[model samples]
Target: MRILYFAWLRERIGISSEEVETAAPTPAALVEELRAREPRYAAAFADTKAVRVAVDQEMRGWDADLAGAREVAFFPPMTGG
Candidate 1:
């Protein structure tokens, strides 16, 4: 799956996006997989509460299923002034 990072997530992870190969069933599981990969990933996902997820461009919960999905994006929650 293609994983995308936005805002500070991109800054912390040092990349905008990347293709990841994983058997993770949910976004939460994917996060665990990434967090275990390296320090950068761990730091980037250290506070999941500050993050939001989108699966295939649709906003979803951390437990959202990833079956047959092509994209998963992580970003800070949006704010408007």
Candidate 2:
């Protein structure tokens, strides 16, 4: 699956996006796999509540299923003026 990071998430992870191979069933599970890879990934996913997720470009929760999904994106919550 392709994972995308935005805003400070991109800066923290040091990449905008990357293709990941995992056996995760849910978004939260995927995050756990990523957080185990390195300290950078750990830091990037440290706070789940502060982060927002999307499955195949549609916003969803961390518990969302990843089955047959092509893309997953992580970003901070948006604020409008």
Candidate 3:
């Protein structure tokens, strides 16, 4: 799957996006796998509440299924002035 990071998430992870190969069933599971990869990934996903997810461009929760998903993006919650 193609994983993308936005806003500060990209900065924190030190990359905008990357293709990941995993057997994770849910977005949360994917996060766990990423967090276990290195310190940067761990730090980037330290707070689940502060982050939002999109699977194939549709907003979804951490428990959202990743079956056949081609893209998954992680970003901070949006704010409007």
User: What would the per-residue lDDT of candidate 3 be over residues 1-81, giving only the tens digit for each residue?
Assistant: 999999999999999999999999999999999999999999999998999999999999999999999999999999999
Q: What's the distance in Å from true for residue 68, model 3?
A: 0.4
lDDT of 2 by residue, 37-60 (tens): 999999999998999999999999
- Alpha carbon lDDT of each predicted model: 0.98, 0.94, 0.97
Q: Which candidate is the best by lDDT?
A: 1
Q: List the candidate 2 regions with Cα displacement exceeding 4 Å.
A: none
Q: What is the C-alpha RMSD of each candidate to the true structure, in Å?
A: 0.4, 0.6, 0.5
Per-residue lDDT of candidate 1, residues 1-81 (tens digit): 999999999999999999999999999999999999999999999999999999999999999999999999999999999
- Candidate with better lDDT, 1 vs 2: 1
Candidate 1, which segments miss by more than 4 Å at Cα?
none
